[model samples]
Target: MDTWWLLAIPVIFGLGWIARGFDLKELLSESARLPRSYFNGLNFLLNEQPDRAIEAFIEVVKLDPETIELHFALGNLFRRRGEMERAIRLHRNLLERADLPVEFRDQALFALAQDYLRAGLLDRAESAFKSLADTPHADQAAGFLAEVYQLQSEWQLSIDALQRSGADTPAKSRTIAHLYCELAEAAIEHKDLKAARERLAQARAADAALLRIVQIEISIAAAEQAWARIVELADQTLAEHPEFAPQVVEAYIDAAQHVAFSAPGQRPLDTQLRSWFDASPNDALAAVIIKRLEAAGSMSAALEFARVALQRLPRLSQAHALLRLRAAMQGDGDEDLAHITQMMNGMLRSQKRHECRNCGFRAQRFFWQCPGCKQWDTLPYAASPVGP
Candidate 1:
């Protein structure tokens, strides 16, 4: 019995050794199934060497096309690194796979759309985002589609895309209004006053308090040579939107100049400007009044107005206007003084710009949408150098 027990223990030990060997072999086979580059890529990723990691992962993906997650990770990495061609190609390849799941296919399409957008291929991007409609990415895709249309200046299409988004937020409303306003401006440029008016009406309906709506209305009125309407609109703007007084006053000055020459019987713009200034006393209004006075050879009146404006606003433009009026009134006929004034005036004109309140983007003229940040109604109408 003792001898039989020793032999049984040896047999059991041999069986245990064979089982351990099988386990080790299975583990090795599993590890061997993954390409060496996969481990290297993981190491590179851990070490923060993205370039090397990308290279190593590309090898793994090339060797194993069945790696679905690897393909997605690699495609995203390419896109984020601005390698659009590679990202587009890889995502396109994923999409071409008939075996790809519906969710993955949608994801790949979205990624490809983003690639085209970043690459400035708007037409291709438009198509890709449009296909994503009604998918899980529908809402995001709709917003991106609107952006695509906006970049293409397809204002109506952008409005449609926004409508499809079905978002009722104030930002969306403002964007839609800006689109209508853009269309109105385009109509104005083509001398289609009727279309312009219709578009502005739509803009107002979208957002009554949007200052750009009033500004565009003034523009349309000016285009029609409806100087009285311009004045009326400006008066309304100053009354309702005192914060936008500078912008409204600037437009008023332009219309007032036209009225001065074209329609003399109309109430004098100068008289109206003075009245407005008396009521508001802002530097923007005061500067215009001073310029009108200077134009009429009322040098003393201009200087007096400048003195009061400087005391109130103390803005650089007002000080420059005051300097010019003082020089003209003193009759200093000094050539150097005149040259210095011209130089200072030129410097001020160059420096004075409509800076975007959102992004600080400066432009010589006003823009409803900030060129830098693309935000609507961000540029404030500050006073500019009064005269040439």
Candidate 2:
């Protein structure tokens, strides 16, 4: 037994020696495979010269194809520099390799999708992203796919893609609601009332407080000549989102003209609007209320309403409204009206009609999305607080 143990020790030592030699040989080969350009690439990266670094890395990969990581790094740098065609070519080369592992292949496919997206090749991007639907990049790929569909105005497909996005559930649901609202707007433009109604219902179900859905509903009611329904939606919007009160003012006046709203022996349109103005105290809604009073033949009340609002809000717009009303009362005052109009125009020249509450970007035109930040429902009209 003692002799057998001594013999086994040498045999085990011989096997360990062989394994060590093989490991050292593999390490030396990898070290010898690294070219001078690999060090140059590292130096360039340390110096923050990414373009030159990318070029050097590309050379390193050409000399030693074992460095699969260099290919991805090169492709990403090309995409970042707006060289979409180069990125697409490099990633495609990786995808064509039969020896690539599943993870590396998925990485290559994702890079190719991004390249196609950056190049505005929507169809190709969509196809590539769809191939990654069940991979680790599923949520991220869905996000990009949603953006592509949104750009193409394919609202239903956009909503479907967003449902699979990486954003939290509430945010994803909100964006889906916005997409539904977009579909509703398109339906309204084409005079498809049934489709518009169905889309609005879907939008409300997704996001009940989305003010654009209310706006579109009011617009649909206006088209159907359902004045009372318009008033109902406007009032509900005001009660829930007072910031959106300004957008509903004109709807009130339009509805009042078509119907006298009497709530079971209560005051009609003029009284209800006055109550709303008193509750919210908005300049735009005040203007609408005053107009409604004047239409009801209460000129004195209208002038008093403007005067009282001027004393409280003390805004240039309110003062302008007061002066215009007084000028109207004066039978022969073209001079006064002209002066008031000139001053109003000057004030409006510096005033932005729209503002993004999220980024504080101001513009003269309203947008459903903030042009500066590209965030949905961020822009609100400056004259009125309405949703994007």
Candidate 3:
């Protein structure tokens, strides 16, 4: 009886080991079946059935907790749907796993950062993005950081982030210059002329062809009463960028007013204004020249300048200037002046101001960048008149 019991105990132990092996096989088969659910979820996603897809994916995640790809997919789907909290949860869960591979860990972190950004949690987003700044995703994160800084009006932080991220691409060079201009404008507003000058210099260095920087520099010189510097910069600016000459014509006139010339009888101002008027024939400049000539006791020269400008452009403003010069010279009464004024008003009604060629945005005031489309160097100086 003792020998029989010992033999039974050995057989019972062997059977128990076999049963445990079968249970292990069953678990393996169940886990293998989980991949089919994943495929089904992917197919549903491809068919644009998110509800059904999420159901299948959730089932798969329950069965196989280590599937990072499904988590990523679900996280991205939630983000696209604007369910940012859910997206953050899914990504945060993935990030918490110590067994996750390095690449997947980075991807989850990036997705989490995106969730924070979309949720307007900028502080959280900034922290999340800072971690990825030196990774493969650094460029995109840096760009987002720049935008965030801009939204916060933290110009210095934006500039610093852009510099760190290699922000100056060939396509974005103009934008970078504009960013510097914004900095300079803010500095000027705060009465920080030194800082403003530094920023303006940076802008010019970034894009020599940017005409707005030249305009700013001219204004700065005018404010400082640096007459010779103004003349030198204005002449260089006009020679380099004649398309913007009309905009800066007043500045040039102001600079000319400051310069002291020899020969008391010499009409130096008239000579300078006439040279510019002849070269450009711009209506705005011609008006300024007309006013200056009248002041210098050269009414005939002033009228001639207005006539030349009107003949060239046929603009209402130029014609008005011409009529005013004529009335002043002839000592006309209200009758003649009133008739010319009416005619000038009709011409003004017919004229259009500057238009943005890129976006078809029209405005009376010139913008270096189009407010409509935010495009740089898009607003043309010329107007598009209706019916010829």
* TM-score (C-alpha) between model 3 and the true structure: 0.57
User: Model 1 scores what on Cα lDDT?
Assistant: 0.82
Model 2: how far is 63 from its true place, Å?
5.6
lDDT of 2 by residue, 37-68 (tens): 99899999999999889989989988988789
- Model 2 error, position 112 (Å): 1.8
lDDT of 1 at 347: 76
For model 2, the local distance difference test gives: 0.82
Pick by TM-score: which candidate is best?
1
Candidate 2: segments with Cα more than 4 A from true spot: 1-65, 81-83, 96-98, 164-168, 261-353, 357-362, 371-374, 381-388
| Model 2 per-residue lDDT at 291 | 74
In model 2, how large is the Cα lDDT of residue 181? 92
Can you give the lDDT of residue 119 in candidate 1?
Answer: 82
Clashing pairs in 3: none
In model 1, which regions exceed 4 Å deviation? Answer: 1-90, 96-98, 223-225, 250-286, 332-336, 383-388
Which of candidates 2 and 3 reaches a greater TM-score? Answer: 2
Off by over 4 Å in 3: 1-154, 160-167, 263-267, 324-343, 346-352, 381-388
Which run of 10 residues does model 1 get worst, by summed lDDT?
Answer: 379-388
